[model samples]
Target: MLDRLDQLQLRQLRSALPRMLEPVMKPNHPTPEVMMASFLQAVDKTNKDIASFQEAHLRLQADGVFPRARASQKNSKGLKHWRASEHPDWANPDRKRSQIS
Candidate 1:
């Protein structure tokens, strides 16, 4: 059935998606800065457009296909800062590290 075929393809794509995102993920900082929230809002309709295109093809429904990158807020020296949140390491700059070995 076409539904089964789509499910299988979805599973495969899910496995490969992370590999594709690794390169795009920022190692030290979250990209597209949170200060640009207003900018992103202006283009919020882009996703709908992409989904419509995919629907026309009837292959992949890419409504939420892409991973969203975000930043966590941290207070440092009385100042608020944003850091890349994809990886755990950059999330909390002041987190205590323990020996795991």
Candidate 2:
């Protein structure tokens, strides 16, 4: 359907589209560059907020607010296979003898 529009119709629709967008522009519409600048300001603020959060997190870690992690014998590293020859209990798996011999 959009493909059917001629150049003039496309131009007219392009002019009207921004007005349809939320925070609707009316008699005096802001240029696309102006909208982009507003968007950039928001992004800058978000970046600063993230930086502040990251700095606070780093401060906490440096001050040892969180306990230091200790490694245990079973502390997860990765899968390991133990030999049955070394651990005899594992050599013979549980088996049920015949109820009636």
Candidate 3:
């Protein structure tokens, strides 16, 4: 969603958002930047945590919930198009050492 915005638009939104949200904000409440950062972090985790993601999907499937088909989905197929991958050296240094042994 944020990918569409240019730097100026993003700056404008960031500057305007605080004033807009101030009316209902509590004294100890998080700023929009912190909230958005946390939200984006969570969203990034959903894409990176394969084992946890698959486990959650398996549980959902057992409950008769299924993901929608991607055939009609028009977004870029980056990681979704991948079938397999090797771990980077930094990502699995212990396994790399074991393989050498």
Candidate 4:
């Protein structure tokens, strides 16, 4: 059973765990603690997977897998909008109007 768990892909862990635990878990088996540890491990694995995916995406972007649009220097209209930040002060009525301009 443990060998089967080791073989499971990170994506398969969620569905496999509940089914495996249901029949074998008992009142005095300390299953809850074991389950919690398993749950944490799954969460950690998921986070690592997401981080790896994001890194791969960034690397692809850097490699120009997706091209970014080039901005024209003569286009002041488009440039002003791009510089607008959503900082707290940016929401102020005075700053909001000026920032967009």
Candidate 5:
């Protein structure tokens, strides 16, 4: 039974081997200039994408909506709280705590 299984596996492998090697049989045809142009176009597109992303990110950051989530603010007990000390007004010397009327 083991010998029959091994023979079946060997036959399957032999049939699949030629298909795997088929890709290596073809030759690349693009000229160096064409390749360079394609590469440059791709690089330019990537740069434009990055620039647009950065611009959008900057705009979002300016509007205080860049991070979009507060999962990182959760504590060990899964509670989220804002720390007043991290705010700019917390360190202001002239700022006085006012009682709510």
Candidate 6:
């Protein structure tokens, strides 16, 4: 039947799709400094936008345009913790260590 043939073709397509898409995820090389700088710039821009939005929301509340404060999206990654003494190797780039380390 035509319906049976369609199901067979769909199964074959599903099996082939993973192989066809595998190369898309290959990692590209990028420097840590470049990534960090770009991330900082993005965070700065987001902070500015959030500040402006908060000011506008406050104005609207004062003018009785909205009854309550608006809820903003919460950051899931709460905070970062870094200790200098914890990873001495990171501080001393000259120190040689195993490749896995």
Residue range with the least summed lDDT across 10 consecutive positions in model 3? 64-73
Give a tens-digit lDDT track for model 3, residues 35-97: 666556654544444444445556656654333434435555654553335424546778879
Off by over 4 Å in 3: 1-28, 51-101
Looking at model 5, which ten-residue stretch has the lowest summed lDDT?
Answer: 1-10
Residue range 50-81, candidate 1, lDDT tens digits: 45445543532333222221121232446644
Per-residue alpha-carbon lDDT of model 2 for 5-99, expressed as tens digits? 25554454444434334332333446877666655665565556555555655675676544443343356477465787777654343522332
Q: Rate the local accuracy (lDDT) of all candidates.
A: 0.43, 0.50, 0.51, 0.54, 0.51, 0.50
Q: After superposition, how far is residue 19 of candidate 1 from its true place, in Å?
A: 28
What is the overall TM-score of model 4 with all chains considered together? 0.38
Instruction: Please say which candidate is ahead in TM-score: 4 or 6.
Output: 4
Query: What range of 10 consecutive residues in model 1 has the weakest lDDT sum?
Result: 64-73
TM-score leader: 2
RMSD of each: 19.3, 21.5, 15.8, 12.6, 23.3, 22.4
Q: For candidate 1, list the clashing residue pairs, or say none.
A: 30-84
Ordered list by TM-score, greatest first: 2, 5, 4, 6, 3, 1
Candidate 2 deviant stretches above 4 angstroms: 1-29, 69-101
User: Which structure is stronger by lDDT: 1 or 6?
Assistant: 6
- Candidate 5: which stretches are off by over 4 Å? 1-27, 66-101
Across residues 2-83, which tens digit of lDDT does each residue of candidate 4 receive?
2222334434444555544553454454666776776566666666655655565567567654453233444455555444
Q: Could you tell me how far off, in angstroms, the CA of residue 65 lies in candidate 3 after the best superposition?
A: 23
Residue 91 shift from truth in candidate 2, angstroms: 44
For candidate 1, give the lDDT.
0.43
RMSD of 4: 12.6
Error of 2 at 30 (Å): 1.1
Which should have the higher lDDT, number 2 or number 5? 5
